[model samples]
Target: MLTMIVADDEPFIRKSLIHVFNWQEEFGIEIIGEASDGQEAYELCMERQPDILFTDIMMPMMGGLEVAEKLKAGNCRARIIIISGAQDFSYAQSALKMNAEGYILKPVKLPELREVFHEAVTRLRQEKDHQLNFEQLRKQVQSNMPLLREKFLQNWLAGLYRDEGELWDKIGYFQLPFKRGDVLTAGVLQLDDYQSAIDKFSEEYRQLLYFSIQNMITECLEKPPGGISFVASENEFIVIFCPDQAAAPGTGAISSLCEEIIGSIKKYLRLDASIGIGRACSSASELEDSYKEALAALVHTFYTGHGSILYIKDIQPGTAALQSTFFYKFQARLMNELKAGHTQQVLELLEKLFDRLAAPKLQIDYVQSICAEIIFTSARALYELDEDIEQVLEDRLTIMDTLYRQKNISGLKTCMLSLFYNLSTHVAGKNTSKNSKTINRIRAIVQEGYARELSIARIAEEVFLTPNYISLIFKKETGETLTDYITKIRIGKAKELLHTTDLKIMEISERVGYENPHYFSTVFKKNVGVHPLKYRSGK
Candidate 1:
């Protein structure tokens, strides 16, 4: 309800104004206070902060004009009406200059008073609505602030802000705790096995867990002056620290904070985290370099194992000292072993190559480049052996994408080994000239019936061999079992249909020879490294 106050020197005038109308019934206003002078009315207005004030233009000690001037100076938002006599006309004009709402002369007219009251009520309602709208908009922007900050930081670290002046401007606007000359250090924290952690909780609880992790990191990092944390991605966070000028460079405080974050997350969230810290950089424009160093150090978690902190300074020397010739020799040897079908030897060489690549100082981009070289080299070798490398790898883009997404060294190793073994097996098939006729006939029948119901027994019937004998010969000739070959063919067809057609999964499953769509989905995920729907969505 709207609240009001009244002030006048005469008691009869005050009583008459109070009873001037049934205010509560006509205007829904509650007369909260009454005073005998303008001084008393100003005090009541300050104390009550009423929505409206009614006062006489001329009064003892303090007049209505003085009250209006004082309230306007104090930034009071109340609507004001001045009551005056003919001699107080000049004072009433002065009150209007102070933004008073209306002027009611002595011997007030009831209709005029009612009309002024209605207008005041309408203005008050509109003001209240505007305030409510502004409050709601403020709350929404506050809630989305973190996401917006993350986007800004992502763009900043990507070197999108090329001009130093513009970068500093944005830094100030975002309230980052760095100036032009301050040295900045970057650190990245990534949850190990983040997907597995999400899988352990219900869908509804996943975001809660992420929030808890973010809060824990914030609590640890924000305790130090000039330290701030931002979400870099869903499972990754970036912490930036600018040590005080009085402190020495590479102070231990940042390292201690990182350790605290690791311990807190493990203690509270029961999750492991890997932290990679970059060397100190002397300017805001160079923060992107520091961020890249931190990420490079973080990716070493794949080699060092999780739940540990790595610093770029400690690992930078090893990467700098690495010889290019060593990598070249390793690649040559890996190709030879793959061509010879020496699986054990190839695995050993791969492990050593990964160990070398996993040096904490090595950047993720360099690692990806080396891995890509190995993939292309292997693909070329398999192509030279008359195998359709595209068919063997399924899709080159999909394979490389999966390789790049590997979170740890082990994941990368597993993906590379899978590709290498598949290529090796295909290359081995070229050496089976002695049994070409038998293998060719079995292959033809299997290829022809891949979309229909066919099995080992049926294939053996067509080949005039026992089911067991057919399986053995197929394995010897193709380096994969008959069942494995058939499954690969069916999955390849399913992938094609998924990419090219809008057919539902069940229809695709039936078309690919699987009667149960659920089983087809399971098998598809096993081979593609993602669920059918997710793969189709390109996630």
Candidate 2:
């Protein structure tokens, strides 16, 4: 709703104009003030700043034209409408000069008044909408400023800029709290097993998770003066800390801050993270050196393990223990144990190999090479027995991919153990007549639980074999696929139920493990040449 003011020298005219229309009901305008002279009208309009104003052209003290001119100059927001009995063309010209909304002859017609008032209200609404849109746009820009600053920080740390002047310009533009010679320490924080940790989320949700992690880290780092944090990569965040005092923050301060960040993530996100701190540097230009050092320190996690706070100053490289001769000797023994189907000896040898690899903190490249040799040699044992690696390992297609994805020693150990155990199962199953026993066990499980959700994988778990291995043995022994066997069992049961009892089709379908009666009917028709109801009726 809009407010309005009416000004006329005569009291009758003022009252008539006020009552000319039900202003609030018809136009959403309420008469706020009444003025008898041009001076009064100008003052009222200035004070109230009404949305619509109506004034007589001729008045005492000041004319309506003078009032309108002064109001325009004063930046009053009211929409001015001129009313005059004069036939002078100059009055309308002057009214337009002052940007009056409309000019009307003395006796106002309701149609003209309504049209002019409606136009003013519409114009005001458009201006108001524009103001609101501008406010929203301003707020969006403000929110994105932080993202812009983060991108700049990421580029700067990557040594993208060579000019010191350009670097300082950006630093000042981002309002970074660093000066020319501030002592800076950089740290890199990484999520443990980042691939496995966030593999369950979609790409969009992964970004949201990253945002949550960064927020937690930022809160934990708020205590360090002039510390700026930004995401350095998919699974890593970097923090550069500058102490407000002359002395730089020691390793203790950095460790405590990193510990807080790790604890917060664990407590809230139920995730583990590790941090690597670099040595302090003297200037902004040396930040890349410190950052690289931080990354170098972080790689030692393969030896130190996850959830560790490693500092560059504290890292001491260990002696190399396992040479090429040692690996060759171990690999030969492992192959013999695997080929002989000595499952226990194979596992014991695996433990021994890892034990040797564990000591002396070997380089990741050396460790990966040895692990690859172990996998291939063990896989060769399976191949000699005419068994497929796909039948022995779950992720056979991406075994090497999975190996490299291991972030630390523990995860790699787990992956290798899983691989060796599955291979051992196949080797042990091969030597013994477990294939016959596996078929019997699968038949017994299916005969008893055919009415439940039975899958080849689930049956394989019960019989200590992979789904592919069990499926292969079952097909070889029974002359049918495992799925066909299960379906045959279900159909045979349905036939017995149909012949022996007078039960509903849906009931028979459920008893035979078919959840949808229509699907059960379809399968029954396809298998037995008739539907269950027709079969029961001996059609």
Candidate 3:
């Protein structure tokens, strides 16, 4: 059962909440405690150690935001959610900095409460699972050599199965050869024109493309003579072929078989895929080398363009020189951007620059250098800030570099964005830069007007700036015009209300910054190409 604590200043409000929720019947939630103010809530939370905390923004002794900040500073495990009657989202934004789990406004509906409760429980479950996984893997590393243990832990965290016994069990039925004269051949499949495909993709379509790729990989290895594993989290597949040897004719036979597999994969998957083969290494213990070579072969996917089978020998190394301070220097630049609250610019620059590494002719060692540079940059930034991500990034990129060795454009995109998201979060948490504080204050005012009365004059007055100057600065920093962005935000809110609530059209209009229902309808149709009613109906 999950334990919950609810905090509010008003007795009537507290009573209403206790009545609204059936702690025992509706959910497996137990009302462990209640408090009349933020200070009391904090005390109760420390004493009771509830799984979730529902806190109001305003209180007499301390505000909920302060309580949340204190809890996060102490590394409290309880998930927090802010409840407030005010439409001023700046408080909620502050709560977000403290890692508050969710924000809900006044006039809280029962369904909304339930949704928040569900989210809190889900987060709790995730944290528990992660802790358990970490503990299990941590114990396994203690007895091994320090360097090997570090490498093994890093691999496991990157979704690579480090337990040879566990990995072999999965392929036990296939019974791959354990002896010498057997061969090992791996194929690298790259999504050839994924950039073009992504340009035409919606979020749902992009997910479909990934799932399709996963299915295609699975299809290719179903009954192969080798033992294959698709580590999708790492975006790479591994096939350990065991048959004949180099002293024999196994390498040639295995290469030919890989070509045949490529043809069959093309006939089916249909999304412009290509394959590359790594040189066959001597022993299973040398799987890492063969894996690297196989991935190096995938780099051919970019040059061969779309759907060509590239053997490892076809491409050669382009350069021997490496940038001495690539990772640390680049992260220094990125950290500066993020610290300045230039999140959008930071995102754009990382994406743009990292894509330059997607070349057709890089050798295995050069490819490793490219991946090392990016991972090193990320790791250096996190480590300098005292984060606990030592070796995690290096291991993940080690796997990702293999998947992208062929310069698989689509695969490269997946890896970069994932890295960027991680990079942004790390910076945001440690940002000591005070520069964006005032701008964020102003931006908060702008965000609150979507479903209510607002104007440049009103917002500027609150921020103590003239309307024209405010608009100019906002555009200079955020890249969107004030009026245009307000319209966009209001329309987005209107759509959300239309889908999530039973509020009538006029009410929805009034809620999202429009005084006149007719004007709201007009803008809705103009922006969404449909009347509000039609949108709600579709949902």
Candidate 4:
């Protein structure tokens, strides 16, 4: 319902205006208040914020034009209709300049008053609808804001956006906390043994558990100067901290915040987490560097163990000297242990290797590189044992995947030990009769025809064996699938070409039996840590 206020200095004029029409019945507007002077009318407008105001041009204390000017200056949204005489018609024109709705001259005609009031009502209804629509749109955008921000941040960090102007425009549109030059520190919080922690719960409860952990982190970070935290991946949460200028916290304070988050998660969620805080960068554009630093620090959790805070500043530089000699010796010993089918010896060697790599002097990348070397060495040993490395590790819970997932040295040790145990058992059970000959034949076929579209059935036809029997015996003796062995051979060939030849990546892909260069690059990156070009560049 529309509400209105009436004002004029003449008491009879005011009374007559009110009595001239049954406002509610004729115009669907109610006279909420009556004022004898413009001053009273302005005060009523200020108090009630009515939809419409009807006032005279000439009045004592304050005139209708002054009221209109004051309301306009104050940015009042009310519709104003002027009541004026011939002499006051010019004043009414001034009110119209102030955006008054309409003018009803002295001896106000009822029909003109009703018509003006109807127009005001129509406008008000239109504005109400527009406002409602605007509000709904605002709410919808707000609801999807988190997802949108995550996508933006993910792309921004991936270097997908290069335009600074567009970046700032998005930042403002999203109302992100930090401005262009504000310093931001990237921090990552990873739930220790995330899969094991939430495995027992249903999907709904698992989400609840994640939400609880998020809330705990938010609460801890928001203590005076807060930061923005979002789930960067399934097991990791990314936090961007732009310290409050008035109460800028030190690195120690950030450490304390991480400690608080850890403690809170333990208390509330009964879960352990490791937080890695990156060194501060001067702007959002440099967030990717900070994010990489934070991730590097987080990787240290495998060495340092979970339930601890790691700052990038505390990580030491790795020596290439140690990686060359020490890691090589370690890998050789580990491979020897695995080849001998000594499960306990292999486990013990893994422990020692981890302990050596866990030294505070080693860089996170150095540690990761050592771990990758261990995996490659194990793969080579399995190959030597006539074992299929791919089938053994094809559970998707590969050493590299575990290296990313495991939270501590113990977790890493468990995963490696499990793989070694499986390898030992498979080796111990290998038959040296027809199965070995069949597996050798399969491996030969893969080694020779890896660059072709080789399938188990095709190889079976060439070897005069059933596809099913070939598959069974091959897995039993080799510990890997035929497809995986072929991939390993093709990837090895691709790598050799990448390093030894000047062939374009497309030619290399064709040579490796991959028709698509993009697919070839993806497989190359998954198997080898870098893209084909980067690997070729020796990065």
lDDT of each: 0.80, 0.82, 0.65, 0.77
For model 4, the stretches where C-alpha displacement exceeds 4 angstroms are: 7-22, 32-50, 70-78, 87-89, 105-117, 131-183, 222-234, 240-251, 267-270, 284-288, 316-539
Writing each residue's lDDT as its tens digit, candidate 3 over 405-426 gives 5344555556766665666555
Between candidates 1 and 4, name the one with more favorable lDDT: 1
Evaluated with lDDT, which candidate comes out highest?
A: 2
- What CA RMSD would candidate 4 show? 21.3
Scored by lDDT, model 3 comes in at: 0.65
Tens-place lDDT digits, model 2, residues 307-364? 8887777767655858779778877777655544556777888888888887777778
- How far in Å is the alpha carbon of 198 misplaced in model 3? 3.5
* Per-model TM-score on C-alpha atoms: 0.58, 0.51, 0.28, 0.58
- What's model 4's lDDT at 217? 80
Across 152-172, the per-residue lDDT of candidate 1 in tens digits comes to: 788888878878899889888
The order by descending TM-score is: 4, 1, 2, 3
Worst 10 residues of 4 by lDDT: 244-253
Better of 1 and 3 by TM-score: 1
User: lDDT tens string, model 4, 243-347?
Assistant: 622123345567678778899888888888998777787656767887888888887766777697877877775553355677677777666555545567777
> What's the distance in Å from true for residue 226, model 3?
3.9
> What's the distance in Å from true for residue 357, model 2?
1.4
RMSD of each: 22.6, 26.4, 43.6, 21.3
- TM accuracy, model 1: 0.58
